[model samples]
Target: MLASVTGKGVCLCTILWILDTKGVFSLKNVTLSIEPSVVQYRNTSKLRCTYDLEGDALYTVKWYRGSLEFYRYTPSEKERDKRKQAFPFKGVTIDVDRSDSTQVTLNDIDFVVSGEFCCEVTTEDSHIHALNNCKSMVVVQLPEHPPEISVRGEPFDYGDILRANCSSYRSRPPADLTLILNGITVNQTEPLALRKLRPTDYSDLQLELKLSDLHFQEGQLNLQCVAQVSSVYHETVGLELQSVRHPVPEKVSAPNTASAASTASSQTIPLRLFCFTMLCFNAESVIKILIKTIPASCVTYYTVVATPVCDYTDIRINSLDKFYALIVVINLINIKMPHNDNPK
Candidate 1:
């Protein structure tokens, strides 16, 4: 009876081995992911391909770009030459020295490198080996220039529609734009593709915003235009408008009016001239000017209005919050043009 039981145990073990060879007991698992799924063209950045394997004797691991094999890792290979290749494809450089069974390294990635990357795994033994695959897409972006923000209609003024156009040019996969008023996102628009520029891989995004409802605090308004190309890439530009208040002149009696006018004329013109000089010194980018007469002040109060002409990218997050504060300051330069007989 004991001999019979031993024979039965051996038979059962054989059956289980046959089942494992036929893949009945296969429990192999493989997973893959790429670090920094996005890359900027012409920028020297590294990409890491990492994978995890469980429950299978790895025969060969392969990395492919859109069905084109670029890398292979073999854990069972004894020959170093058969382990990995530095340049599997022409002009395709893989850092084989840093690569191993679980991860591969790629350096100096460019626009041509964008594609779906897949990792494939196969077991050593054909009878029981499980085949698995995992894939992730990568995006290579062209260097994006700062978005250009221009006023669409009449220049910015209190209580009027502030229509402006914001555009970010020469970026891959276009950028989304947002218009902000005094720290609040007033409006957001989808990216509109512009005419393709040079380096055929890049595109532009243009968006327009019409701000009808704007809140002015202390006679000042702040506007910011933000562009986002990807989760890792974005930029902003800002502009501000301010209204200054000056004391009104006290009315003078008829007899003293002439004397007062003469004295006012002498003092007011120089003050206006000084104010004009100060305005020029304060802000260099004075793009627009609106001239008006203030009857209360006797001397003309020139609201030295300036419009934002350009946008520049600010990458530092610590400084981004203070971006609007640095918007060009508006200064009122009360300049009195000498009264001449000829209107011209």
Candidate 2:
């Protein structure tokens, strides 16, 4: 039975459809529409169900969802049999309100249960019926962490190029290199350079820092260098800018050009200064002096350098060719020079 109507005709049809009692039942064109078809994580995704009925005899209607069911009766099921108004909606049902309603709600959603839902309605008019369908899906993603740094080398010394390099050694992805010197930090976009780590075959990453011009201090110098790579963790090793002490020449030898009469003076000055470099002798350190007079008299004096008094003079001007060094700090008085003949 197809009932098409305008304004007044629609009202009349509604009244007749509601008042019909003894007519044959033929349920057809039971079109259903649900509100939402998709959902989000932890959010409530549901649907609003609606339908279009065919004839007046299609009174008793039932709606079946996935596994649960519900029903609504016409002409007031108050007079109908108790067994006739049975609803498929019990404990595991949803949206059980309003006539011509067939909506279902998905509660407490996760990544597991994302699929389609059906809205099946049956008219108990001993004839035709209709239903509808809807579906939804949920997606998930993971998180990530930033990078870190580290360092390597034998040791550091004064005048040694304190070679310090920067590398993103241990990282999931190769790191973007950065450098932090003193108090300033270098960004990644700059033309950063990292020397190839020249470690032994069995070693890890290598970074170099060359810090020179170590001062003449008593204790260790406090210096440091760190490597900063984007994916590499932060690491630093205290560079103890060690003082590199060179070997000081031993006792000053006599002037090679000086003969028995003319004592060497100018040439012996440079030789004496060489002994001041670093004096470590006989398991201890001692300072030996090379004294020269302006009149061309040069002498090597082995005495307590602090005490000008000659203590135990080993060799000097007088002991020429008689010692291991061909020169000594002995008292060689009367050693005169050739006549210069300059008038005063």
Candidate 3:
């Protein structure tokens, strides 16, 4: 009887000792990395989360967003209840395998699934325990709109110089812009290569098409341009170019009081003086006076007013507003003509 009682006492003591000396197991070297940080529209991306642990201790795993629960797994039961109970996790999936350490695979991410995540694993050895580890999942969204084009220029009336611009302000990658003028790609994408053909904005994927050669046929010239953009989001978009109507330059026969400004370049200032000397001898003094006074302004404005001498002359160029550089040069030539030398 005494031997039996001693055996029972030893068994009880062993149970207590086992409970007091629990082993401490920890999940160390935990890592999570996604294959692509940027996800394209309607695409699949892989995500891997893994860790090394001391033993095959049953872990109670749970994924959380702030205070809300994302997913949960108990290694002892080792069952996955696939559910996206959280705000954006409803479409996501998880794969867990404890044999090769715990790994969770998340799939089908959208713009809303981007946020911070923590993987919780509980482990214990014959000593202590551990709690939580955090990582990040980032999902990039695709571009929705193509590059928009805005065309600027004086529209209506023939010879109204127009400005055209194509800007892809909302795209991740810059756009490849093309200019289609009157059924022809008139401008090639080259540096300073015969660009006088049309108006183009080098800074913007835009253009400034001049109505120099195009006339108001039938009614008005139909001008159109388009901008194309391919984005990192694996999407390509083409925007309709803006169209503007500019009028054909008017036939001039009216007289004006303001002194006419010459569109002649500074380099041609000397040539103009020689022409003025000839006009004084052959043409009316009013025409000669105009040649002297019509500096720093457009010749078109002056010729319309300087007597009806050259009524049929049609060497029409765009008014001084087309080029800023030309405006300064043509307006600041400082031609020196004295009123005393007017044609007598």
Candidate 4:
């Protein structure tokens, strides 16, 4: 009886050890990796599942998109053609040629595919060990063009108010918009506005800046608008601001009455001429006086008189009365009577 009991106990311990070993070698470290977590619409993506099954064989590798099974891989299938399979699902197209138990290729993904994706693995063990991992993906419909920035109150002047607006349109998931002024971000005091159309969305942001001396300290203000959709898309538009300042008025002194009168008299004088003859007169002296007092256009002709004892000249003067008075004084001082050998 003692021998039989001891043998049975040994067998029981062996069975327990085998069970513990099997449990220890079950599935572990199951991880799911989805490339390009942010995917553009109608683009391809790849998902991979990695697991350490110890010494167990892979029973099935199944992929789920939000609780719906779309792909399955079973190595234990008797028929080779039935081992890998794909199910029809909206927005999910599997590339069967490049898919296997470890990884799956997704083609032509769209907005409907943006959600949690799970990978489940089961081992061919008596205990049917299973494990699953899930990750998220986002599909975005990018805008055809970058965000547009516009200013309402342009040609800004000091102490004026400036208004600006930024717009991003036609995106499935609306892009975020930011307004920056001179490299500094401008806070959005106004509420953001959204307009949704079929298959796309639009976003708009407004900003207001008060023009002051501080804003124009650097001579010009720089404004920018940035649009972003996660890490997939980014665009920027910028504008420059300058303030217009009016020029200061200059001072003017009162006019001089005496100078004004003199200028008026000179301009209003009537032009005229007078002829004079003198004895023992210098012809060159008379000619010089006439040229200074008369304009060249008014003078018709001039005659110089030469005598045995004196020289004289006939001069025509076309000038103001002040100039004629000056000529009479010169004649009195420069003329010398031909020494009257005969007294008259």
Taken over the whole model, the C-alpha lDDT of each candidate is: 0.55, 0.38, 0.46, 0.74
lDDT pick, better of 1 and 3: 1
Judged by whole-model lDDT over C-alpha atoms, candidate 1 comes out at 0.55
| lDDT by residue (tens digit), candidate 3, 1-344 | 99999999999999877765454434566665555645543355544456666564645555654555656655455333332121335546443332123444556655555666676656645544556666565554323455444555444444665565544334222334555554556442334243332221221355555554454444445444444332233322333322244344568986543334333223223322222221213445535555566555545444555443232222222333434212111222233332333445
Off by over 4 Å in 1: 1-27, 43-55, 86-91, 126-128, 142-145, 152-158, 184-214, 217-219, 243-344
lDDT (tens digit, per residue) of candidate 4 on 230-325? 788889988775445533246788999967865655422233434343433356655555556655532332223332112234443343454343
All candidates in order of lDDT, best leading: 4, 1, 3, 2
Model 2 C-alpha lDDT per residue in residues 1-344, reported as the tens digit of each score: 34544666889888778645322233334444433333333455455444555443334444444554444445445554442444533232233332333444545555444444455544545444445444343322111232233333324345554334433343221234444433333223232244343221111233344544433234344333343332223445443333444322468888655463234332222222222212122112223333433222423332323333323433333222334332333333232222345724
Any runs in candidate 4 off by more than 4 Å, and if so which? 1-17, 188-199, 245-344
* lDDT at residue 78 of model 2 (Cα atoms): 56
Please give, for residues 1-344, the per-residue lDDT of candidate 1 as tens digits. 99999999999999998877665445355566767667665443333444333444667777777777888887777888688744455434577887877677777676677777767766654454444455554454644577766664443444555665666665666666787777887777643444343433333334344433345554455677787766767788887633232122467756777567757655333222111222223433232222232334432323332432222233121112433323322233433344445645
Best by TM-score: 4
Question: Which residue pairs show collisions in model 1?
Answer: none
Candidate 3, residue 324: CA error in Å?
79
Best by lDDT: 4
